[model samples]
Target: MRTTPRRLLAAMAALTTALLASACGGGDDGGGRAASGELTMMVPLFGTAPDPKGEVHQAVEKVVGKKLKITWVPNAEYGDKTNVVLASDDIPQVMVVQGKTAAFVQAAQAGAFWELTDKLDRYPNLKAKSEQAELNASINGKVFGIYRVRPLLRSAVLYRKDWLDRLGLKVPETVDELYEVAKAFTEKDPDGNGEKDTYGLIIPKWPTPVFCSASPYNVIETWFGAPNCYGDRGGRLVPAFDTEEFYTANRWLKKMVDEGLVNPDFATLDSGKWNDPFVQGKGGIIIDVNVRATQLYGLLKEQDPDGYGDKLAMGGNLKRSDGQKFSYPFDGYNGFLAVSKQSVRTEAELDEVLKALDRLATKEGQTLLANGIEGRNFKLENGYDVPIDDDDPAVKTINNDVDFAFVQLGTWATIGMGVYESMPTSEAERENLRLRKELAELDLQTAVHNPALPIVSPTYVSRGATLDPIVSDARVKYLAGEITEEQLRAEVKRWYDSGGAQVVAEITDLRAELGAGGN
Candidate 1:
């Protein structure tokens, strides 16, 4: 309803005609230009855009055997810019689409982009794909983009080992133990300054309560046996909040708040400063991605190098009271690189583009993008790449180029993309990497995925913005003790009455049509 095919077709009639004409009116090969050694791409820039003359850029060009013309749009403005580009005639050859927005879905369905579902196999590196990633990125059961890869099981509990040692509390392996540890951390003066100024958890105000990915609350919910976002109930797919496990998890989290174990301002605390409490020794626990442990360790080491060792500890998802482990899983990809049909014009051009991307996924190409020129950006230290300090002006520019440009184009996280290993020089780094790998493998065995991730529900899309807040607001109210359990149930029923029931029915039928089994 929000973005009907009819509406999109009407809105894009002019642009669609232009795109078709361009594709048909190109050169002899039907490609807009000859098979030049140049490729134009658009990507979101999270930091300052790198200088074009930087060494890293040149290194990447040399490795990929192509002159790269990158349009670095600020991340915040990328979505808007993408919308504009989707409606214009001057589209880039390749673009990094952040998500399958309604406009993007319409554009893709209208054949604005090349469908690479069967084409990826021609390139070995690009052909290596994760099943979960493919499922999440598909549009109408077809692949339109080469998805960027991420870890499938990225959740972990981060805690302060120093605080635990001082209080004689062991690392929590179960939800009940975690509660007890949190209580002790809050009430037992774990800081040992003879003052109770610390709390157990450092939960910030989550960005959205609907998606709930990466939220500490979501971690607790999944550990309590709730699904990641949606759960399959008797062949019926429904939102996770509709499950009994979600209710139980909410009650448990509310208990923590009522007992003053978690940060009081968790509802309003900025996520940007979520680590500040841990750094200031005001909190001792953070349930987040495992990679955060390495980052936190680095920050602590920067402040106190000698004492930072063994000061931090990491763990995978905790077990429920029944000793069953369940994990919150990432979608295994960020976004994807989509090639434009108008720009590519022909299958041969598409092949050339895919080949270049395949090369980027190779070991030599990945190393160049990630580590830069060996002697310039890093030095071989005992056969391991040791990054050079960026204090020098030249090194700083290279580092910026790495972060702001080359790294953004990396697909190294894709399974079998290429090997880009670096040895850890410190105990913290070693353990962090070890646990990251170990926990990822362990959690994957028990990860719970959302069945509705790939489903296209018209009702949900149109009414989702209105429908989600019903549960999200109710959950917040229940956590704040402003509403009773009965009130929360009533709110959920209200959601079903409004539009959620229709969403459930549609998703159930669609799942059946797609032959998607239970989670």
Candidate 2:
């Protein structure tokens, strides 16, 4: 059970009672408290790995003095499931959604969630978090949802430093340099096996190239001498797939293949290979998420402590002509929570839920989220959070059995930066601090944040969801020498022809409004 404060827990139990009586008929806009034992909560399964429990959440339940009874929902199938549930108008007392933020917006508009803007102060915990995080609760001026609190980071290239040094190469800081390193790494075995068993790098798109426009590679296309892919010239938000940067990156990738740099089978590179190759000491470089670097370090320390400690290097973005560091686009706003109009029939109920979510957004929440049941799951030593007796077989068993993935740490909202949310164990904290510093020191030549990231729209965010697969397939075939770049170009034209133009228009419009197209 979660260790929510006793008072907050009581309030939740009280809210559940309110949910029972007013849950029917779309809840009233006034204050409400369902009758106890009536409300159910739904949340996307927090852990994608084998572990199923969240200790902080358990603490929340414990604090509430009752089981919230949260059912696990998969993010992949969220849209379909949400639609089905919404169609039936049968929802849990609390629903923490993931995936498809636009749908959330639409749902909230249709009176799906409870509004708490007018009743935020009652839950001091939630209110405090919201204020500290500067979390946005309103969209286009309407209070719609509360964002899931996580910090922001500039993503970068992850490489095996040992391999680079072995190959006598410095970290590549430009597209051209990236190519050169890939080639040399390809030709010269960095693994010391003396066999051509490894590829220079492994940024997979297999069987096709896959990139997130909000990613530095896609959004900062212009820095690579390509058009900026984030928005249309008109300042309207557009999809990255429809942008010229998409084609440019592909072309660059194709050239790498032609030059015997990147693996031709890259398009079909499996996730295991993408991560495992580097972990096992095969591939050298990867454009990875900010979290994975730390996660990889953890995995390495556990599996091959010495090798992990000695082998890896977290690199920054490749620089542009002017030596600007670039970053890929990532969703800035994590999802939000809103009150259902039906529930606010009273201010107190609205206050209750708002308070709960808000509390989950700040430091107290950060501590609980990352560390889990303070004295129980962990011990604080010198202001650092550490798992209890981590070396103990019992501790290991419990950690493996539970409290693994719940440690979603390092959000700008939580610590204002990655430097602050590191592991509390002196050792763990050292690794995190070092890694965080590595990220910070990455000379970002061009801080090209994903252009379309701010706009809340379907056409932009979802455009690549379908086309990315297609492009990936086509690019893979071409890179493996199966298809021509000309063919790839034609396909890109097809993309532009099919809804790409519209996306461009949207981007242009968005940009014009923000006065963002000057560069």
Candidate 3:
């Protein structure tokens, strides 16, 4: 019954494969001629896919000196598709691997990707990447890809400035002050609606583990003097959850939940809807990246052009009882652009692809990636590029289209490529950007790093999926009062018995080999 469709699909697939081989200029030794024809790339799409004929695409093609053939996979299906692609021999020439996952590591080790550690030094822009970002992107000290730069530190407390102003409360500087402010926001009707319908904090079901920098719990734990993910405890790396500060922070959060200051459905709330409650006046706090404050303010301005004036604000990490501050730091990269050996097939082909990427990292290329074709998407005024309003559908379609495919191909944040040319269109946007910069600087002064992030563990790589859930599940249970402190400790012990100890031992050895200080 299925033979007709199956045969037809198989014939179509073969035709596509043959076409790609012809266009890619199949297998020739590195010589006078560089790799010819269109370069193929696979990248995840956040929203609508960019048009191949768009001005942005054409500009990028001109800069890179190659016609690009890109496959736009949706974000939700990327992980599964990446796994399948890694297992096959038909990978794209350039692929955006989202993380250094077990499959990616194994594939890289097996020669599926070109080893790029020593090779990067040949390209000035690639070599100029931040040391930490490169380290975090490596697999057991070997680099197989060029990392996409993200901030080393970006987390902050995003809160309702208007609520704090109305309640006569200052931005919280200490843990105790944060708690009291939360209580006030919950008890007092800061919205002036004469109804106690709003809570203090809006915690969603966080997507990552509790130890990740993105987790609000990790933010509070680090502020309470716990390590970032893993800490040097007694000359050995240990999970942050094992520390007393972690429990203290959790107990404080639990108290907030018990007091009804936090959302009751936080454990099950969708992260996609995290900002909805804040926008709807049902919550007053969200601990996230600094840019979220600007985004929330922008949303509020759009909703109530006259009423919502400076409704959101951001601040650095809180000080502890002893007046010591600690800040959670990002992993310093989003993902990497890996050149596949299968599609490239030769040194010359690899060089051609890397050269295109090198051009993409330059100031001119970075400017194009970030702002798009200047006169079309933005206009220069007062020595800054002010983005034109994208209200026009035609303008919006062509704006930032190339970025969807190649934005992650540059080391912009880490190497500081291009000019800081963007000027906010509004006074409110300007104020928000200024405030974010100030708070981010404060956070950087007390950044706490995870010593284990760069070090690879065989046990963790093989059993991390199993090992991580043991701690994360217990943590969620502990927070919800489903388990007591004693039970939580038991779960931690269980984790140690289940490959965590091996992971710790490996990390300790690796750190020692690298001569990294325990602190």
Top candidate, metric TM-score: 1
> Considering summed lDDT, which 10 consecutive residues are worst modelled in model 3?
1-10
Local error of candidate 2 at residue 479 (angstroms): 3.6
lDDT for each candidate structure: 0.77, 0.51, 0.75
Question: Sorted by TM-score, highest first, which candidate order results?
Answer: 1, 3, 2
Question: Which candidate order results from sorting by lDDT in descending order?
Answer: 1, 3, 2
Q: Estimate each model's TM-score.
A: 0.91, 0.74, 0.88
Write candidate 1's Cα lDDT for 212-322 as tens digits. Answer: 455787778889888777788887887777889999998999999999989998888999998889978999999998878666877898888889876788888899999
What digit string (tens of lDDT, one per residue) describes model 3 on residues 1-519? 000001112133343444344334434432223377577888887667778887777787888888888888988888777766765546788888888765666567666678898898998877835777687777766788888787778888878888999999888898898898889889999989999988898888876553343578878889999888888998988888889998898899889988989988888899999999899888998988877765687689888887666687677788998898888878777788898776777787788888988987887887777667687877878766666777877678766463454454555632122345467656766777777778777788788877777677766766665677677778778888899989998999999998888878898898888777644
| CA RMSD (A), model 1 | 3.6
In candidate 3 the C-alpha lDDT for residue 309 amounts to: 60
Write down the RMSD of all candidates, one decimal each. Answer: 3.6, 8.1, 6.7
- The per-candidate count of clashes, in order, stands at 0, 84, 0
Q: Candidate 1 lDDT (Cα, whole model)?
A: 0.77
Which of 1 and 2 is the better model by lDDT?
1
Candidate 3: segments with Cα more than 4 A from true spot:
1-34, 209-213, 345-349, 383-385, 389-394, 413-425
